[model samples]
Target: MRRREFLKGCASLSACSLLFPSFVFAYSGQPLKRYKRAHLVWEDGRPVKAKEIKPEEEYLFFYPFRATPCLLVNTQQKLKGAKLRLEDGKEYIWKGGIGPGRSIVAFVAICTHQLSYPTRERTLISYHPPGKKSSLLERDRVIQCCAHMSAFDPAKGGKVIEGPAKDPLPAVILSEENGKIYAEAVLGRDLFEEFFDVYRRELRKEYGSSKKAKEEVNRCVTTPLRKYTKEVIRC
Candidate 1:
């Protein structure tokens, strides 16, 4: 079956309740959050122009919170909007990619499975463009986590196409004005509280305090995934 059809079937299946018991009937009702608009800037603090972003390249930035990382991508295709279902059973429409060709998209980098994220030292989760081989059999464009081999399809609202991730990656809602991109909000269930609890010491070391780490970001520096993380572990 085609990928789109498969996703549609997934959306309609009652069996999903069994496959994802943690998400079944656990409707929190709240599925989205409007964050302070954050400009995507370069390391020098200059706004990142949408046109300059290379196709299939992955960029990393912080959004909504200082400690939370997001992945930006230019998929080089006009993507289709998707219906994203949250753990709480709430659903929302992801209006698809933005910018020229409707190719630009972004998603929270923390893995939905275990919250593995990109860091200055290493990244267990990273994007693999088409034709690039990873530990997984999938060679298509995917954001994969080596920690547990969870793979999300960036072109499909970060849908989990493989492995243990039961929920979709939270998408970063993006807008463009005068060729520059801005992150306006996040859509889907966020694991911020669990993330904080699990990584408290690391957060404190990086941002001085958990409170500081959770501070809303106004402007975020966008860097290539390679430059942002010293090591990229693909599995």
Candidate 2:
């Protein structure tokens, strides 16, 4: 190619890079965009206590079980991990332990695979020691999704064991308070909540339809991706 042509192309690419550096790296080695997370307060108008959470306790009002800020009171002692969601829209790498006589070790509740929300509704298989089989029983550790069979050690910063997931779940900063477990700085709680509300309504409307419930559901699912592009890309 001519030198003039090459110079012009370089100039054009440089300008474009300056404009959307985040998108450029999104495909290669640039890290995923990390946003600031605000602290999550409990329904009682107090900061989340970081003490051992009991089983059957609700952390986030939306989901139940050991997912995201949900309480899991166990009777074992050792380092453990679980999938948890912070109030923020981002996931975390949570790890902790249940003192031998202690009650439980809790963390965020998000699947390591594409951030799919895993629940106690099903069993999730995970790899704890980086490449070992770790069955995520609803009653034991975090409910790892069996979709791709990803394992995570809650005590070890929710590390991925054997699966396609590359990054560990984000960890919510935690602290103990007055004998209660308090979670701190959930990545994307409020935004997800808001988005979830609108998304839920649309899904309900679509599902409530009898003739094309499946079609409606598919549309409802993809609708957010469209909306997200509109808001982020300003299209």
Candidate 3:
């Protein structure tokens, strides 16, 4: 089936549909968290200007919580608004990208399949820009998790297009002002609890404690994924 048709069919299926068993179901309601507004800044603390972001580059930043990472991208093309559906069949409209050219977007970096995320040592998941070959059969731009081969369409609110992941990556809603971008909130099912549970030992070793790891942030530094991690393991 064509990609568009497959996505449409997936979206229209009921919770009781055959595809339900394959979905990694999360809590029912769409959870929305309005975090303390955090400015996306550089290491020197200068605000990250939206217009200066290079197209198709993957930037990483931590927000809402100190331990949780998010991916920022500029696809360089105006994106269509996408209707995103959660595993339990809940739906919400992602209002396309923000900033100049309406091409900038961001999402929580943790994979819904198993919560695998980018770490300082290595990243199991990362953005594969258009024309970039990935282990996944699809060659289009996607946020891919090599751990399980789940691929998410960055242009479509991080919708899962392949592999086992069922929920769209939770979006980090952004707002731009005075040419700078800020993360305002996260919209989608709550996955932080599960992520924390699975990574508690690592989080404690890096953050001192799980509580500290979850602390709200007022400033976030944006760095290129290469600068953010020591290695990128592409499958």
Candidate 4:
């Protein structure tokens, strides 16, 4: 009787649709088109004139549209943002779209899990992959989303240190002139909206028409690799 009951329970479990992996997302191979240099604007659309944040702190701003939120942070070293093949036989830190130097950094705040954005406070705890020892090459800090517990290393070009998330959060390339910072363009795939690519195609033709401007916008990037196991790349 117990064996028969166990077989019936197994059949019931097989009929369940709810599961951990609702779906898996892959990289879109299209050339990045969104994000052109523009005046820094506040959430209310007023032009910003000066610095509003201090070191190790972040200030949130919205531009291009309300649905997109960007983050500007002050980090110690901008060296680990993204590893890019900028020169002969060597990869350089691509600013991951943010400007060079450790003074300030900017990136889109959209989380990779379900495309939900994490809060501004430094609330995520540090993490290490199972059975793997920590190293200096790994990121020192991680920004976590409580929704799914995925963590992104802000210093390492917003790479996903822990997951269900398979991609890094897209970056908002920034430029600083005199004493003010501006949102230039976005890097990487959109986390939540599938229609963003369509919108970028039209926006690109309008803003990034010039070849020189297009090249300038294209150089900085972070390439996230696909790994089905825990031995994932850190930078």
Best by TM-score: 3
In candidate 3, how many Å is residue 225 off?
A: 0.8
Candidate 4 lDDT over 1-235, as tens digits, reads 3434544665454343221111100112222334445566544444444345444334555543443445665554545446433112333233543344543556666665565542223322222322333353343444555456667666776666677776766666565567556665555554424424434553355456333223332122211111111232232
> What's the lDDT of the predicted structure labeled candidate 4?
0.46
Expressed as tens digits, the lDDT of each residue in 165-217 for candidate 1 is 88899988887877778887787877888888999999999999999999999
* Per-prediction TM-score to the true structure, in the order listed: 0.84, 0.39, 0.84, 0.51
Residue pairs clashing, model 1: 27-88
Better of 3 and 4 by TM-score: 3
lDDT of 3 by residue, 1-235 (tens): 5434654768566733444222112212335567888999988889999877877578999988999999998877778768888999889777666876567999999999999999999999998866676765647567889898988887888888886999989888787878878887787767988999999999999999999999999999999998989999886
lDDT of 1: 0.82
Q: Supply the TM-score for candidate 4.
A: 0.51
Q: Which 10 successive residues of model 3 have the least lDDT summed?
A: 20-29
In candidate 1, which residue ranges exceed 4 Å CA deviation?
1-30
Clashes of each: 1, 38, 0, 1
Ranking by TM-score: 3, 1, 4, 2
C-alpha RMSD (angstroms) for model 3: 11.1
lDDT of 2 by residue, 106-143 (tens): 33445545444423332232212222223343334443
